[model samples]
Target: ILHVTLTERRKEYEKAKERDAELRNLRDTAKLQEFFLQEIQLGELWLARGEHKKSIEHLTNAIAVCTDPNKLIEVLEDTLPPHVFEMLVHSIPYTLQV
Candidate 1:
């Protein structure tokens, strides 16, 4: 379900002008808030594109910079699929572990 949707959207986004613009705009922004959302969106894009490592990189960065728990939760919920979500869910504790 979500697999097909994200992959298809990835393809469409690859051809989308707005997607590129958003990517570029977000990357250029220096503010943490702006960068975090852009990074999350970019992570989704990368994940959809089957670039898991890149996706993780951006998603991790997003998680690090997020000041609002609600917004962070929203991105976590919306960006990840079952398998990816499961992996991330397990990794959360380790990520936070000192």
Candidate 2:
């Protein structure tokens, strides 16, 4: 079920990218959101696959683009197990503290 949801989100991300290109002159939050969503989805997928390093990479990317750390934390809490979230926090300690 999660895989299916992720796949659907991936499709939405692709479409969003196309729309972003077409509306390049416009300043929109959708682009950032799409990138964030994609990164988070990839991070979760890697986590589920036991690829902690790759998961951290994608999660870091997501964090880099995020405007709200608290919101990101909320999403992470909902999506990732507590231990995995702790690992991610430790991996990017400085970034999270910022």
Candidate 3:
């Protein structure tokens, strides 16, 4: 009975560890999403205000953190003007974080 109890406790501890890790991942993902949205929104705001350089900077930051930049780029292509989109493409870092 003691051995069974120990085994059960060990299994429970392992399950708790896995749950903790998963929660941490979820929190990190949420934070990343918040940052990405903030950058994208700021970029759009600057772009609408005709601040090309500032817009590019924020948009570049957004792309840097984005997990799937190609998809984001496609969406941006549709959202931004051709010239602006071209500029953004050039501004992207060679080594993206994601």
Report the error of model 3 at residue 43, Å. Answer: 0.7
lDDT of 3 by residue, 3-47 (tens): 999999999999999999999999999999999999999999999
Residue 97 displacement (Å), model 3: 7.1
Better of 2 and 3 by lDDT: 3
Q: Between candidates 1 and 3, name the one with more favorable lDDT.
A: 3
Which of 1 and 2 is the better model by lDDT?
2
Model 3 residue 49 distance off true place after TM-score fit, in angstroms:
1.9
1-98: candidate 2 lDDT, tens digit per residue: 99999999999999999998878845467778898899989998999899988898899889878888668877787878788888777767665556
Sequence-dependent TM-score of model 2: 0.58
Q: Rank the candidates by TM-score, best first.
A: 3, 2, 1
Q: Would you list the clashing residue pairs of candidate 2?
A: none
* Cα shift from native, residue 46, model 3 (Å): 1.2
lDDT of each: 0.73, 0.83, 0.91
- Indicate which candidate wins on lDDT: 3
How many steric overlaps does candidate 1 have? 0
TM-score of 3: 0.83
Q: How does model 3 fare in lDDT?
A: 0.91
